[model samples]
Target: MVFEPDRLPVPAPVIMIVEPYGGSIRQQNPNLPMVFWDDAALTRGDGIFETLLIREGRICNLERHGARFKASAALLGLPEPILADWEKATHMALEAWFSHPHAGEASCTWTLSRGRASTGLASGWLVVQPISAEKIRQREQGVSVMTSSRGYTVEDYLPGIDVATGEAKGKIPKNPAPWMTVGAKTLAYAANMAALRYANANGFDDVIFTDGERVLEGATSTVVSFKGDKLRTPTPGGDILPGTTQAALFEYASAKGWRCKARELSLDHLYGADSVWLVSSVRIATRVTKLDGQKLPKPNNEKEIRALINKALG
Candidate 1:
């Protein structure tokens, strides 16, 4: 469905159902179903997923993205994802989607959904589609941003912390509601949508969430900045997804004789940085021009930073 830019109510596009659990797609394949989601994955958000760009039929950072996806599933007490011949499945999905007449030139995503099983974890599927290149272009020119106050700090439930007894005990917490899959790219994405809505209502393009006073990440991307010669991002301690683009920046920056580190970041530091940008699989790298009501100065080394990102993506 086509949505007008000035419409009051945003329209949810008709998501094409390429595959469904126990559906005809499964019967036809005879192998594993193309996509499957069990009751647990659908109802309880008990699975993990990943989205990556496909350029010229090649999935970007496939190995790294897959490793993170599997790790997140395990963290949520879900069954380990089957990796056998998964790369071939991902490529097939991308090729099919890109063949569409309206497919654009850049920015696509492959999503994997794990189905719920009666006794085990669940089944899974891979979905591939082209994303809007215009959206990426607009972000590249810089976008207005606001802060969301609805998410929790990753530190609240560190990997080793216990939630049942309200003590830092032996085991990790068991599926905390609301932010259960904060680190996982699960299908349950209401909070992220709410933050986006908040941004729209306030005449902003996007929102960055915080856990109390600590800056976590944007609803859809990783927060990155350049402070002098140092490239900094929030460490993937617990509260944020470990973005592959963010990881790539570290390697790229260091090779160019620049310092890169992951540490706890504060709002003031983000606001006061020499340059601030959001990185993700789609956008790759884009600057943040305004935060709240304040306009930030353009980075002195914008060209250098952009070069670093392009090199990394290649």
Candidate 2:
């Protein structure tokens, strides 16, 4: 299930400009110029964004995304977003998106940025577009992945720790380094894009980032592995962004008698698991068919797993 770059989604997108404060949500031409040239979103990539799935006619996991959006804004010292305004803007974009001649599975993004350097205001927008057929293909056929180094260890997240004593005298602080921006979904995605390009260049569909030993996460998704009846993922509050889709999966799977755990994981954990998957809001779940060019063991209950994933997403 190798996917080519051209197989990516090409649906016409609809955009809506939103006011960070209490202002009107107006529809805008996505192809036309909207933001100013000096906006931090364009010049310095200083902003936060979240992409969510649109199933049927409504947005999926809106509250979770809203919480994350606010958290990211706080991390960047930006003003808190009004989720109601964003909701209205998303509905506007969705209305425009469904008006298209051919509409498929759709998704929307909430983009909030620090406005122009002069005014010192904030700019926000909502974009709704159809999800790619390639994503559907990957969901059904699985994906091949390669691992990349994140260049920092999880220990780095613990600030003020004495390396000599291998411990901290007080309560161990987690992700204390604000500049690292570990959990925030900011707009500075050059490195993530570069990792994806590198993976595609190397003949893989996606990339999983590791801290040389512990598995951090997928480039754009969360990594989940199942062994027996236990489902496990890497612990968040470190360098990994907590996944909304994965959280939904855990909630539903737990009720179905599946044990879910978040702990430090390694590549060996994935390799030794009965099955591995990459989960996200748009893609739902994509199984790992191959890891670093080696074929992985297939899950015995693949059909059941897919059914569970669909139910969880719903």
Candidate 3:
């Protein structure tokens, strides 16, 4: 069976196209043709994007998303996004989306791509849609995850690092390779989506990618495990995209006197943790109830953990 993501019961999403040259925002019909066939974003996936949560007319965690957006652009060698312009487009899309009869949380994704080779200008746009019930359900009820090998080792990113022992062979190189696109949230997500499909085909809600020896991250979310008073996530660098939600949670948890750290995580850590969660911008926090068909132990203080995650999410 194919895994299909849940969709909102809407006719069409609100689309705000950002002009390639002057940075002007224009509303377009979702059913209409807007992007050109020759656009590199379509042809080569030569672009980057960020998905942000919109609650009560406000975009949650804009600063973190913006930082990651810029970082992805820098990694992809794309032009820096104009924050003011994107902010304006976000509001415009939100206004358009809310003008409809929709309710509940929504999301806005900003996409920037290299323009047609003939034109040399860039293309940018924003898409606003309501968050689906499936995501809400997963956030509330938790998920059953399957682990899949990412085929490459973390050592590819953090050179000389041992996946099993979590030991560095030597000082990691300052730069690995530009083509790696390790941390950038680029449009080239076919592999990631394929991983999700494989997991779904195997009767799993989501996938946690591992390098055959050590865990990496979720397909689209971050892998975070709580043991004792400490909150630990996979160390972010070339192996995976740095998680904005995880970073925010760590900051809030740290202020609340919870120990937070990033390190090379193993499957044993999750299987042995008090509780495991998959965190992302839209989903916020979703507990992992099972891994690879084995039931995980319940969290000792699930209620308190949920409360803290809700507070941190807000």
Candidate 4:
């Protein structure tokens, strides 16, 4: 017999279905961890999702997150996701989530799976829950990292630049590989999960996937470094998922007289940089204090930086 994710009844986190595969848009009860056994989301992990932060009943960067969500769904060959439906659903969850007196920072997540396991019908829903303590800890205290090879070269991605011509050749490769789902935030995250597991097993807080010496990105975050007056991150048009937080932060930095740059970063460059950070939407900004057991320089104005990022994120 197929079972649900519960033995006792639970009541929290409102769920809304906007075009439920073959079903119409509607709201579900906020009490049970309900899921039919035939959900592809669990069976094959054929889905796309986004986790967003909601503070004091307001979603942080809802527009950007929604846009990315639609983009991800498109990458997965799923139907168009109505941004208005998501926003409407989010408001419903937010209302139920903050209805409690002890409410704090809440996380709102929406998942769009290929469809039902048996029927192949599209399925999607949104849920709101409290943020984890570890995320909060990473925000309060910085994190450590270990570099691991993601088994893909940087050039394997952005193959646009003509070596001899040295001119704009365009973005997509003339001949692309089957498994090269570089930037699509698909649900097939086994590699990402494995990388983080390896890091934790080795006493590290997170893993930054690198192509030998060429830095790529973190398992669930993006890497950025600061030196002198410039803030640098891995270049776009690569295997790296374009970081929403990184983009926003760069814009914020530029407005405040900080020069932001994007390029192919080397491990040596990152190690020698004055300050390094692992940034993401949910974790926000976590300064990298140690890499491979070697302590790195901590920013003197950490408090100021944190404040600035929080303000930017907000």
Candidate 5:
């Protein structure tokens, strides 16, 4: 089918914001009411969101995602969300999306904003119907990646200096103001989209970001890989948002007898790894075929890693 960004339905999801005083639910979209968010998230990027993959109408690894979302919100000083209510909202959103005729196999996003201007915490939801099954299919063939140099990394967590913008690739000009939500999955994603556009312009599928000279993550996914029996990823110690998929993979790798470590990684380590994969809810595990202009040797253990992920998801 032709890829139409607007027609895509929201994947099954919901969001809520809970503060010390009270909480509110944001389920008002007719098609995917539970997936709606307020303008604060859109305009000011003052919110956090979770993108989840629904298989057979079931949210995968939801608890992990929720916990991480809460952590990110706390980092940004947003009100903590009610996890139980959010989970119910997610189910409601998913049911609405799946019931729609146009809804195909797809992914969905759940966003929580701080209230409105008067309150300081507001949340919203959006469910994009599925489009471009081909795009999902292409992930299996691996992807080409480009790198960006515009972002920063925080090696150690200090008060008030938590925000880090890792890279910007395309039309979205770098913001002169320091955005507080850079490390959170806030709605201000123009920077991430710009990186994606940069990758597309360069004939690649995505962009991996770096802080200074250390590898961070992709515009939309977390980077991980196996180097001879060792599985490694960039530690969340820096500005990188800790990813749910990355956490799950670590568990799976450990159960499968692989040594897992989280540390700082440089571009040199990424280019020389036996296999480099990007992890997220929808894409799951997509191998990186090339970086910059260098083609990497296909990992001899691709099948094993895939199996590990499949088992974890199950």
Candidate 6:
């Protein structure tokens, strides 16, 4: 395994603020500083979270992330997080980030988890920190992706349906599995992190997961592709997490004369695409210049894409 200390900065004295049980807000110095032997979020990963970009003073796509956060919480059987709670906590985190020595481009993460329900408390916290320059460089220079199997097919999440989009008809499947927790951005991300680590250990920058024969998503980002004036991503009906950045990019690109679609994708399709990308809130859209050690067909246009996305994203 490669240890790239420069690439991943070890956080020092993590500054964070919290609003426990949706009550009065409080701040914590250096790390969470909480004793949670019974916390479901930590032990069982029974929680929901959202990582959002704080551009200037605005939470990029607050409404979109808020909706997803609430939905995920509800699916996980945790207390729903209201938008106001997140907004209040986010501003507090921004305050902490600005005071930090390494602050620049900022990212905020809000986590709402199942706490001691008998005590009528649910654990929630919002922490803001610097967006790493190495992460930005991945977007600036592009990243390589390696495909990994999800073990579960798309049917485990969204059964019997193919294409989906935020604007598509019947986007959410009928009778989705409650235990599946598909499309919900929950704190149960160990598998996702493991996939990324596996890719990193093998020399790839990131991972693209596949369900059965179809490509699903990047470990922490949405897999996006462009072919013949079409911007395409795997449909949420395929149980892929609906990416806020990917959807926003599609909308932004649409205004710029690019047609966008959310549909079923296969590895073969990506291999034949003109260009590919892995998009997330902080990373925006990072070009996939190489996949599985083989250079992809398209020449990288990250500069042009980044400028357009940055303008649109900001």
Best by lDDT: 2
Span of ten consecutive residues with least summed lDDT in model 3: 157-166
C-alpha-based local distance difference test score of model 5 = 0.69
Q: Which of 2 and 6 is the better model by lDDT?
A: 2
Q: Model 1, 1-314: lDDT tens per residue?
A: 89754343322211222232232221123233433444555666655667777665567767778777766666565556555445555555555555664444344333344544664535555545445645666556987888877554444455422321124322454654433434556666777888888898879988888876678888889999898898898866455666888887788779888899988899899888998888888767778889987898898788878888877766
lDDT of 1: 0.65
Clash pairs (backbone) in predicted model 1: 37-115, 38-115, 38-116, 115-122, 115-123, 154-239
What residue pairs are clashing in model 3? 160-169
The positional error of residue 9 in candidate 2, measured at the CA in angstroms, is 12
Candidate 5 Cα outliers beyond 4 Å, as residue runs: 1-38, 100-104, 118-121, 126-128, 131-135, 152-155, 160-183
Off by over 4 Å in 3: 1-11, 153-178
lDDT of each: 0.65, 0.84, 0.82, 0.76, 0.69, 0.74
lDDT of 4 by residue, 164-189 (tens): 12332245566665344445567888
Candidate 5, 228: how far from true, in Å?
A: 2.2
Taking all chains together, the TM-score of candidate 6 against the true structure is 0.85
Residue pair clashes in candidate 2:
none
lDDT tens digits, residue span 1-314, model 6 = 89874565434433344554456776677544663677777777777889898887678978888877877766567776767866886777677666654455678888887775455467877777667877879977898888889756555335222222333334456766635545677787888898888889999999898876689888899988877677888876445778888878888888998888888899999999988889899888788889888898654554666676676676
lDDT of 3: 0.82
Q: lDDT order of candidates, best first?
A: 2, 3, 4, 6, 5, 1
Candidate 1 versus the native: TM-score?
0.76
- List, residue by residue over 197-305, the lDDT tens digit for candidate 5: 8789879988888876788888888999779989899876435767788888898778879899988899999877899998888888888888987898797777877
Of the two candidates 3 and 5, the one with more favorable lDDT, higher being better, is: 3
Backbone clash numbers for all candidates listed: 6, 0, 1, 3, 25, 0
- Across 224-247, the per-residue lDDT of candidate 3 in tens digits comes to 999999999988765666788888
